[model samples]
Target: MNDSLPGYAERLDALHQALAADFRAIIARLPWREHESILDPGCGDGFFTGLLAERLPRGVAVGLDTSTAFLEAAEARLAEQIEAGRVRLVEGNVDRLPFDDATIDGVFSAHSMQSYPDLPHALREFRRVLRAGSTLAILETDNVHSIMLSWPPDLELAVRQAEHREIGDEDSYIGTYFPRFAPRLLAEAGFTDLQREYIFIERQPPVGEALERYVELYLKYLAEQTSGRLDAAATARLAEIGDPRSKRFLPRQANFFFGSLQTLITARA
Candidate 1:
């Protein structure tokens, strides 16, 4: 009964691989304990859950996701780790975690809140299960809110026009204001003592020569994905934004990405 996209598990694994370094930095900061239980709601494919197991030698990590496809992927990937009593998988939704109130010692979720039907309700559920004085950690990309593309004067409007993304929608509130908005939500749900950190990957030419190539191809990619969104003038503008051959293109000193930002927020429960 898993309703996940056909290749979601595979795609998720690939993404985790690409994000391995950032993931390690985020996981390394957890105040691990020998006898603690951690809940990872919406854990996809167990790549991170296995990393958690490696970090928390004596602790138990439980991962929950609605997709049986993902659970199976986790099981297959973490077979030895799961057998050693380090990790467990459950099939459920974060909106209604399958656990008693105030039972979980810690909770961590990533890239999952944006899809929740009722975000505040889900936050309440997260707080309900978390033990008082424990930790709640979230890692997400704040592209919708904070990260602006260096090319466009109005990146938000451009995205809206191109992809039909709505203003003040999930893409607006969580995507834009996220971890920035998280502290307030956590406070309302009775959490305090907040900490926010970010791992940024600048998509600049000097970061690598491939970035120049990436930038150059971006215009064509954009045009393919969204045909009429860019007119002739916009095409010329995009070339200036992305084409390394253009005189107006960015020099090596500018450390900027096209339109992406990744962030991690940790707070007390």
Candidate 2:
């Protein structure tokens, strides 16, 4: 967790609530069997980790993350499953998994790869921990079509270009470029049977409370990330859209709608 982002946990929980349905849909797409051990890397609040446990009646779901705060929250959220031995939470990093080799039957990660400093190393670790023919599924943001705020084309482009330069292109938009590069990366890491799927979630007014809060917080986070990089007018516009008190608050607009695209890539180890 970034110390600067005080609301990181809150934002993650809100996002889980808002995208619950879409996330469940993506989980359903994973090739899970009833009695197979599954690993969920970067299982932030254990939202999807609990879901994965439910899918495996006899098997266990191991949720791993580097953040102790996140692991603590996951522990509480998944206490029942943990007590039942259906779930376990571990504090660890993706690039260096703690599990033994060829143990996990399947691995599922959601929107977590972008944070990793060395994605190739993490992918190799994922491959190392999986048994032969096990499946690995990852969900990443498609920044190009994600969080469309209805901004003018030029301003949007300018903001993106500036943000990319400010935060390195790979770190800023890994999801947008994943499809183009993931195939080779996975192949080199000893994964095969590569597949890709796109998941879309859109909301129109009157949006639910969860979606409304999610959009507001997400915009604010983006605004903060691209803070001094934008021109004065663009900065003010971003602040206004993210500010719930402002008349131009995006979610409250009469025609307000939100859409997101996430890419799900799966491979066999």
Against the reference, the lDDT scores of all candidates come to 0.69, 0.82
lDDT of 1 by residue, 1-269 (tens): 43554533443454456446667777887885757888888887887787787777888889898878778878998898789898989989867789999999888887777767677778889889998888888887764443344554664366437744334655446534566677777788777888887767544444455444444454445545555665667556655665566765643436554434667778887
lDDT of candidate 2 over 77-129, digit per residue (tens): 99999999999999888878999999999999887776778888889999999
Clashing pairs in 1: 145-176
Pairs that clash in candidate 2? none
- Model 2 CA lDDT for position 194: 96
Q: Could you tell me which 10 consecutive residues in candidate 1 have the lowest summed lDDT?
A: 5-14
The per-residue C-alpha lDDT of model 2 at residue 128 equals: 97
Q: For model 1, how big is the CA root-mean-square deviation?
A: 5.0
TM-score of each: 0.74, 0.90
Stretches of candidate 1 exceeding 4 Å from the true structure: 2-12, 145-165, 169-172, 202-228, 231-260
